[model samples]
Target chain A: MPSAASSQLLDADFPTRLREVAGMVETRLDALLPKPNGHQSVIFEAARYAALGGGKRLRPFLVVETARMLGGSLDEALSVGCALECLHVYSLVHDDLPCMDDDDLRRGKPTVHRAYGDAIAVLAGDALLTRSFGILGEVDLPADVKVKLVTELAMSGGMSGMIGGQVVDITVAEGERDEALITELQAMKTGALIDYAVRAGGYVAGASETELAALSAYARDMGLAFQIQDDILDVTGDAETVGKAVGKDADLGKATFVSILGLEGAQHRAKELGERAKNRLAPWDKAAQTLRDTVDFVLERKH
Target chain B: MPSAASSQLLDADFPTRLREVAGMVETRLDALLPKPNGHQSVIFEAARYAALGGGKRLRPFLVVETARMLGGSLDEALSVGCALECLHVYSLVHDDLPCMDDDDLRRGKPTVHRAYGDAIAVLAGDALLTRSFGILGEVDLPADVKVKLVTELAMSGGMSGMIGGQVVDITVAEGERDEALITELQAMKTGALIDYAVRAGGYVAGASETELAALSAYARDMGLAFQIQDDILDVTGDAETVGKAVGKDADLGKATFVSILGLEGAQHRAKELGERAKNRLAPWDKAAQTLRDTVDFVLERKH
Candidate 1:
């Protein structure tokens, strides 16, 4: 699909395709979650509220598209995709809590805590987190593969990964000039899960070791570029356009790629990394066209 | 070990044995967690504080003893035991948060939020929850078995289980009591994990379906007996002996077995359940002697 004829993602209505997949995930999630009724049903409502509306669904898209690229079953990939999205949303819900990021707005809507009181919001996130693993375990795949996927997802999001990264991000002193620490923080905070998205698809598709490694290289570079672009957007994008709080990083004087490397430098690095990421799929030829286009989109996305 | 020759549990120091296992789990948790030296080291410190230095280790002990009874490797069961404990402690940490039960102390120490601030405490629980899955994934076993274990753990502790039960416990209205709802609440809130502890051991040991069913029956009754005895203790025991607040259930006007059945009625019920639970293990006979003894201990213990 990456042939010159398909080089333009617009040919396939890229945003339209993303929206459809996002919609599909929303439906799947709705069906998978416990209905909001009975005692403490508010948590289910809150969990649905946190997961159902808004956001780009980028991680789920990666799982589905990558699995499709590797000739895996779309249905199976979608199941795992929903699990990934549940995890991502769980993180967002927790991050927006008053005790955490203290944000009231997310995706042009009130954050879970703001909408449903802090206590319910906390339970919503916890329920969502637990639900993700349960969903993964229920996927119709070979047991071993499912186990590996759960393990990968857990490691990527656990203490040494996404959650761990968040801890460091919020604790670091302002104006510290340690680029190494900054990179590690970003790698753990965001890169770990993004890398796992690609890896999860590869595992589901039974990709060989060499193929999986190649996928990892592409994902790693893409994740870095994605974060760089994110930092750029945080500095340059408006809250309305970004659909959430922005410039807070600057206001808080948090170290970012754009802060250490000048704006132009960060942009240049993002472009270089994006290209390298797309190039890693060259061995797979046109089969990885969607992924190649994805890297391009990541660097170019306004949000 | 519960034979006439081994009746000297106090002489052999049963509490001492419990403490030793608790100590071992603490060491393992210490090794499993991220070292608390980085920017957000407090989360790690708090997670350690929440998980270590507390509790009866009843869940972990169940895993170890059950697996040993089924001839599974002690090392494998202990690994799973620690994972279960991580999950249990995570619940306690979150439950004690200001948004939930709002308790100030647990296991005779300040709650995580009180000690490390609410945000760090929240993150600590999140980290520990994530860490539990990571640890389960890392266990040295067949991938399929590990997957089954993870799947079972998630199901038992997830929205449909412990978390779901906690949501109900906090949200249900005062009085207007029903025995069925009360039983459901206690089962989901406490029994689910205990059932899984036994089921986890059986899975590790690769027990036959008959054996697993037998284990499940024993766990189910034992859990009920344990909780009933607990309610009795809350009414009869003091803060100093209980090591945490007591009488809060009655204070909150919550409907418990003691409230519904009356104290004497509840005590008689616990004894009946304990006897039934012990009888279920007759097939394994002397092999399940320790578990039988545990049921007896649950009925008679002061705290």
Candidate 2:
């Protein structure tokens, strides 16, 4: 396995290619969600607002890289990546609604609710959520693969995964929560989507069983590490830097990894998890090298 | 075509058979959405609360009937019916949120938000919506059929249909809405799903172009009639009888068919539309006889 420092030494062309792929995905997403004409125009606009609102598009990147790693065409994974991002955006839109985290900011701008009012925001989230499946189901892929990918995406996003985590997080916020509960919540809420990103990419590429197993391991560890770092940043990062209002967890009385594990302990866990994630990718081809760098980037990013 | 009086003459065995089919569909839905063990338990429970909460199960019934109309098995259409119901339930859950209609009752019980709090309700809706596609995609149908069905469902549920109509409803409620605008909104919000119910059933049965076209015409007209009757009921029905709070549209200052067209005009329009819907299905076989009856039932029902 490449060392963390070595992983960062990616070819100069890598960032350019990644950006190009991201741009392509963005265009396709725009095409997939056309603005509705006539009476319900606002709903379509609200959906577009939530979807087009800026994010790093990291999930799509993972999808493209994982597909490439398994010797699959990026074209095959393009719509899948867009679908994943749509699901992610939908989750964020709902998460920031008045009933959930009740936040007003997202990605350095006012959230859907803040921008479009609560009713529109709720509908926007619903539209984006349903639209993801539409994109996936309409993609030109093999039937079995399409079924498998769609099933995996649903399981990851639904009660068994992301939604499940959100419920636990809400309960913890409303009452006293322990370290174990907090970790489990984080895994479901934040980690499930990331894990899905990696696995979905692999599935689209028709990765071997061994490769899939390895990728799953890598994703699980990376997802947890990413969440831990997020918790650490919530404590230490500024609102302007983090791109959302900071310290809401403390205000909400929510349990988090940093609150339970402590800053140093959380950092230690993240580093260990990142290393483990990297180790899992050791059996993959050179195309997976970018994914390894992504893990390191997850650990090192300040925001 | 079955006469209006003939349509009312429910086959002595049809209701019994429908109840049986509904039971089977319910069982399948339960099997498809099993509660995952551990931290995800709360999500599963909330999902069940919203999903299993009893309504007429009208959408699923339509799916089964339309499939049978096209010489397909109810067994084959079971999952499709279940998926449509899932989509319907998800919409209802979100629509009842405090930010939306702020409804406190649904199906003679507390709304999802009132019962499970807003966060869980939101997540529950998200989970159900995603799970619908998952169910459709994973069913043992041809890939092309799955794709078409999923596409139809998503389109009906997304910007051009349900969500769009909702946005228009909310917007027009803030001001005086014209008759044309109100009709457009109804066509999208209510008509879209109703249209999809028949279309998806035909899709699963491998419907021909002509049959699909005829069914679409039948569905479109019936859907409008259904919405018009719903508007009339909002003005005329009692809360206890309807199982939901009545006069919500006027209370929210939302324009409706009744509001824009007057009660007598709205009722006349419903009857006219119902007739048109029935006429469109005249070319179909005896199996479509039940569907024609359903269109009449939609307009004539008290609740």
**TM-score (chain B only), all candidates:** 0.92, 0.92
Report per-candidate DockQ: 0.67, 0.71
For model 2, which pairs clash? none
Expressed as tens digits, the lDDT of each residue in B205-258 for candidate 2 is 888989989888888898888888998999999988876679998997777788
The C-alpha RMSD in Å for every predicted model, in order, reads: 2.8, 2.9
Off by over 4 Å in 2: A1-5, A8-18, A173-179, A234-264, B1-10, B173-176, B234-268
lDDT of 2 by residue, A1-303 (tens): 666677655455666766787788778788888766776677778778788746678898899889888878688688899999999998899899887878887866899999999989988888888888888888778867777777788888888788888787666454567877776777788788888888888888888788888988898899989988998899989988777678988786667788888889999999899888988988864657788878877877778
Task: Report the C-alpha displacement of residue B237, candidate 2, in angstroms.
Answer: 5.3
Q: Report the C-alpha lDDT of model 1 over B1-303, residue by residue, as the tens digit.
A: 234334324334455666777787777777887777766566778888898876788998888889888899878888899999999999988998988889997876799999988888888888888788878888887888888888888888887789878878877775655777878888889999999999898888988889989888988898989888888888989988876579988997878899989999998899888778888887876787777777767777887
Name the 10 consecutive residues with the lowest summed lDDT in model 1 chain B. Answer: B1-10
lDDT (0-100) at residue A225 of candidate 1?
93
DockQ of 2: 0.71
Decoy 1 TM-score against native:
0.94
Q: How accurate locally is residue A23 in candidate 2, as Cα lDDT from 0 to 100?
A: 85
